[model samples]
Target chain A: MGHLSAPNDIEDLLRTLSPQVLGALVRRFDDFDICEDAVQEALLAAATQWPREGVPANPRGWLTVVASRRRTEMWRSESARRRREEAAFASAPADIELGAVLDDSLELLLLCCHPSLTPVSQVALTLRAVGGLTTAEIARALLVPEATVAQRISRAKQRIKASGARFRLPPEAERSECLAAVLHVLYLVFNEGSTASSGATLHRVDLIAEAIRLMRQLHDRLPEDGEVSGLLALMLLTDARRPARVSDDGALVPLAEQDRGLWDAQTIAEGAALITHTLATAPVGPYQLQAALAAVHDEAPRAEDTDWQQILGLYELVRTIAPGPMVTLNRIVAVAMVRGPDAGLRELATAERDPALTGNHRVDAVRAHLLEMSGDLPAARDHYRLAAQRTLSIPEQRYLAARATRLAPDDHA
Target chain B: MKYLILIYSNPQSREIWNSFSRDQRAAGLRDYAALHESMVASGELIVSEALADPSLAKRVTSHEGQALVTDGPYAEVKEYLAGFFLLECPSMERAIEQAARIPEAAFGLVEVRAIMALDGWDI
Candidate 1:
């Protein structure tokens, strides 16, 4: 593998080093905008030189030094016009100590997850600043307009600066709230990939992989946080089933119909171990509960053995812990599977009346399935068509459209 | 760097301020006083003031080498410039820091633009 200088290997190395280098520079220099730019410059420098000269022995340190130097130059130019509060940066130490450059990804995460920015801004900035992805790359993968993404990232940075959010972890009293913000951002990334909101494709492996990579980093930085492990485990186990989530022709495959043989055993084992450890301590966080739910499904040898009763119990626990219409929707499905379609319909009747879920496509989709299960194919087809029209995702529309068609009767003259 | 800090207030914003209770309005005004005091102490505050509502404003425009006067603020714009502060700050970030401190900024918008120094002019 020494001679294997694959392009992907270098990209992966740079991705890991970029955030650490950027985080280190931000901590040292206290300039979010300048640190981000300098880090990008350093990464560009590495990409040009590393292949020809062989990878550096200490790439992270090398990038840190280069970015620090670049940051100093930026200060020099800005200060030339006018003296700034950070004027001391001109004489930044030449040898940036390796030890002083702590891996403050937590700090970076907190900064990127600053509450002042909108959620879309937070996601865009998190992907660029900490995920080490370029705006074009992010736009391309997520299918957002490049201009929109660029504007969002810059605006988010300005908001963070203007709001005066410190580029460090919040004090102990507020740590959990800030941590929750960070976890929410990571989960958004994961969800966007695992189930894309709108796009030609059903799934984006690039984004899913990036989310998992960042979660692994978060887990490493925060080993004691059971929720972190829980999130990572949940992502891994869910991703292990990705291969069977879609058919060869790109049709959606429901979990019950997926081929168990297609699930990645190694990933499932790793996630199962993490969840087992997490549960030994009784992790009551939503992520842990979801992981436990996924684990039960993964452990089942066949679809009929899914342990729906246990899943129903877990769904109830999730509702109690984090009550929301979405959880209620999931529980409604589980009830249908465990008890009967009529039971599920009864549970959803309230949701149908609730203003929040009255027009929700997912609720409609679930209702369509329950109706189909209860032998009301015509009503199921109508609801499926309603769901197809309501969803923004092209793939989801196709899936629901197919469902509606499957329920249609044979046309006879 | 000298920055032109433009403070924009929507006429509708008055509704918000009016909706506040007497104590809430007092607290907001107190916060503004503190913000103004700090900026003045830092010597970054050059000139600042609040403006009357847009209904009391006028506009002048020239077309085809002729001057034309119009009533009210620019009709094409939803948010007219309500007031401004000319600030001599060290950097853009510092200007933004000051802009964010403005009490109205939270309720409306604050724009920080660098004041161009043409030739030897300095303020």
Candidate 2:
């Protein structure tokens, strides 16, 4: 807390400590719902007071004390109003060791991403509990109503309570599975920010930053876990190109067309170094392979200089380990880049049989690109139009429609 | 999931209702009351209400800055929405089961439709 020079730095410090303080409280109080609310109140207090009064000697300990007091006060008033003696006893534990709170960030993350909750609920609760975002902030980041975010978070916590899950890690048999759920939630949060599915704005940077921050914390706690490191690296590598991902006029610039000069060289280097270290040291997971793929993209000085051979090999490994429709589509792009457009089109025909790919705009967009490369201008234009019509993202629609328009006159000629 | 369970009224159903004995009509009302009570007890029902006469409905259209009014319950349509139950169910199957419990389902006039969220799909 000594280097808390700027207000932004203080905000970051608060966010980083929010989960640790909440984890400590919930572990001791054994009441996640009340503990979460108390922690939010504590965070709000810190946000307002930290900059004015100067940073505390131990920010995390200070937050835990404040939140614990709030929790006791809340329960005490409730118990008195209801005349429930047990509530008072439960609220004020005699052995409260304020200074000896252990970091329970991993356990908190597992609880937030509980499998009983729906993906939407998991995303909302994870943002609030682990990422340290408020309901209004989460709603703004997700382009959802505040009520919806609040409902999801509350319902998720209730479900966790109903599941009878404790504030600790799962059993050895279930630990890896639970950790996978946590990683998936973080991946979803990052994806939501990387691509605004149905919004006017292309990127919700707040969510992206939150995802990376949470992933970094996870990595710090479980440094030996390859997938955690891989995910952190992947997020960094993907986010590094964000500066050049959009045009001045707010249109999305596809990867091949983006000006590489605008990419964050420092972030790329960091991500590259991390992934390179991970792939060498740990057993390769899907995320690590994806990070490797992203690293290849980031290392290329120009779009034309991209090593499609290496990328294609990596996509193959990613597909083998974790097959997904998007991975299939990306692999086809690499196929076209390496072999030929006709070869890619042949692969696309087989991939079109996948139920998940049916009616997906990205498939159409990919097909259009391949057809354009194969000198099938009319077909490419039609596919572009289809893609433009199918996509919900405004920027993607604009870009696809522009591609179709660019080829319209050529059709007549 | 939230669903709108719509009960449709047609000329045939209305004729059958009109022809029912007093005892039968009262029994029908009892069935609806029972269903409403069960839904409320289960925390499934958000709101439910019967409609006014469809003939009283009016259609409004703007034409060159002028508002034009026309009689609704279009003559060509055979079925009109009579009442609806707004229910929060766990799944489509549950909503359908609730819709089947409605008295109008005997006439094949009850329908269950999922309510769309703001994003069209969940995150």
Candidate 3:
């Protein structure tokens, strides 16, 4: 497990309550900007005031009152500036009581992903609004500038307001597209967590945990959606093997070399059941295909017994829908195992010619392994050197360099 | 959100593109057209246009209070603006996805920028 900075109880309490408090405000006022700001202020207030005073008997009530008042004040000041004196939200919410507000995290996530925003904005807004991440936290997670994330979120909110997007879920006819957007963001978070784009650590487990938690919550709300279950299954199956994915020294372990006994059986079973159920419904979506692929790997008790042929077929399907270098690389590896090294080399040569994989470390790593397998130690050494040069992770660099060094004693390949 | 998709063509990409077979060029155009049609169907495309050849270009400048115009296809950069698309998308991902689907993006580059505020012109 990656190092998880265990959030203190206070931050945990606030994070848990954020969606509910913000949901209530949005439901009552329907002003995303004002309500969001009000709720943020209220959460900040709770962060300070909650510790000073004993926990309130009615925490939601306290938050509702504070956020509502803040929103009302904002509405009043804006109307005054315009000199319109709008009747709506003119008075403070002194008498308004905290009603039962549905957990609107899923709804809020969908709202943040409204089609008018770009993918970057959707991810930023979702992390801020539903994930309750500060802009700085989001910036760190995305490996981008704080200012850029701030601008994207601000612009997304403006676009949402201009489009008059609804806070509630869309109609059934439009639900599929909206759901895809929601799943895409979650998947992105999962990918980032599984393999961080840069820096020392190979994983960002916090994001993985966050995404899984959110997906679990979503599954609880909409259990019937096969794709939802499929996505959750995919994430779980992938996360299940993470413990065995790294060595004691933190170097990445290839799937074939990983200790199979260390894989989490409970998670694998849960994910397998979900994938089986989802696939029974004849769903052939990206998540389902990926989950099926994971299942094929997890079902094998030993690396030698892995269902490479099944995985190869699944990869072909995945490539048809989502053609990319990484997927092709995996497929190439599978082909190498099933057909032979030469067959894999033929496919990999085509992939090497692809512009998408130019200078990509994974591609070079695969090339080195295939060349080594084909009894071409000199070429393998050269490719390993290239692989070491291409990667950012310290562990990956060491691993590739070790391979290069093990192959040849002299500097010349 | 509204995005400006800028299509850029560099001399290297231009050379590679010009070396394509006629059928390959036609296939590239077909892909671009298909991508545009899909965006139109999804209501994500607000406007898109391919710029005329830069060889017929004119440059205009303003000094103090006078309008100055110069005629020539002259630029100092290896990359030149080839075309653009103004799209009202739901997210940056969609805009980028659309931009990447542009045929020239295979050899050149496509950059997507979100407009800050719509104070001028009409949506």
Candidate 4:
């Protein structure tokens, strides 16, 4: 094994090998905390040894071999007799195949994001296990206290172990439901990057890139899973416009005002191709249908060229499969664009009564826009204020506030 | 190989639970009984039982120099431990498979833990 020379190269190698080593240790120990600690120790050893020895030819394999030995040493140091017995058992075979173990890491990823755990825990654990991100990095990404993120990760690992959650993709019968949970976490990560639930910037490119990487991994593993392709398409299409999502001054830019030329044509093309391929496979699911709609919007050269009628039809299909208030609210906007603002406002009024949309900021923000367009300036102003108060993201709040300002009477101030 | 499965359920929703018809209760009981039989057949189940009502439960915790006793349930939460099962399996994967088979997991919660085989412990 040759030692790593360049510091930058070593850092990259460590980041890449972290997940593999963690996956192997987790498999052997069947305890995330112990596995994580062992992997960290192995990393520290690498940091000291690699600079002197140069980088290993297969860094992942080297890390696994070292970490496995360290775990055995720790177990033995804790108990002699048990260690002796376990050593004898361990000597029967050294079955630590790095490639197979890394493949199984996807199973671990899904297990971390299992619906059984809370959403916060799901995201935290996924970042830890899959992204190989430190707890502090996760804390920064989530905009929470580092200690809180640390505690959540610890509790989540403990619960997973105590629940005896298997680190494997669920059976085919349950794959759809299980994959939905994984996709939900990835989608939430993308949404956070795009709008930033609460952050100084409107978008975080790193988060979006990580999500795209994971989606690509899923697409590679499950080529036949249309929803996986659909999700990748959706992410690509949304991310294609990221270069135009904000102004040079870092203020939010709505899609209508965004520079169309700034959008990544390559991403848009790939997304459109994926959506078309998924649609060609008859009996497309909700996600694929939604991605198809996004593909259409991405193909449109301008806001006026948007096929709202087709978009509305896609939303109806999505509602049939996965009914939710967010989808309904989005459909209402499409209806407003095509039919009339009054019709859209009426739909929004009914949607506001939905338990799911009761406190949703986007619902109120859309209502404010429809009201403004319909000439009800006072009601629009009130709704905009309500939206601004409910929203957590500074950029989103600023946008709502600007809308409110436009509606406010000059004499009122 | 030894696993402990803890079942959690809402103990305070008498109105919702009591509304179940006799057939519903019987169906629920049958589901649980079938799970127990399956585990026993696989030679995984060691011991299992439903607990008494939460009102009869007692909790003992050591505080400072003295042991404190608690009345009724400990956490004052609607969801409380409803039952438990001890199983011996070939691997953690098998243990999780058995945990997922538990009827309580469908609508409630079932947590599984591997028994620590430290010195002085026996399974």
Best-fitting candidate, measured by DockQ?
2
Local distance difference test, each candidate: 0.79, 0.84, 0.78, 0.75
Q: Report chain A TM-scores, every model.
A: 0.92, 0.90, 0.87, 0.88
Q: For model 2, how does the per-residue alpha-carbon lDDT over B11-31 read when each residue is reduced to its tens digit? A: 899999999999999999999
Error of 1 at A51 (Å): 1.8
- Winning candidate number (lDDT): 2
Instruction: Write model 2 residue lDDT over A1-413, tens digit each, in one string.
Output: 44344788887788778888888888887878888989999999988888888788888778888888898877676567655556556556445665545458899999998888877788889999888888888877766556657777877887888998889888999998999999999998987787653344433447788889889888988998999999999999999998987677766688888899999999999999999999999999999998999899899999999999999999999899999999899999999999999999999999999998997888899999999999999899999999878765566778888899898965543
lDDT of 1 by residue, A264-308 (tens): 999999999999898887546999998998899999989898899
Candidate 3 has a DockQ of 0.02
Q: Output the better candidate (2/4) by TM-score.
A: 2
Clashing pairs in 2: none
> What lDDT score is found at residue A9 in candidate 1?
86
TM-score of each: 0.73, 0.77, 0.70, 0.70
The C-alpha interface RMSD of every prediction is 23.8, 7.9, 18.4, 23.4
Per-prediction DockQ comes to 0.02, 0.09, 0.02, 0.01
Q: What TM value does model 4 have? A: 0.70
All candidates' chain B TM-scores are 0.78, 0.87, 0.82, 0.76
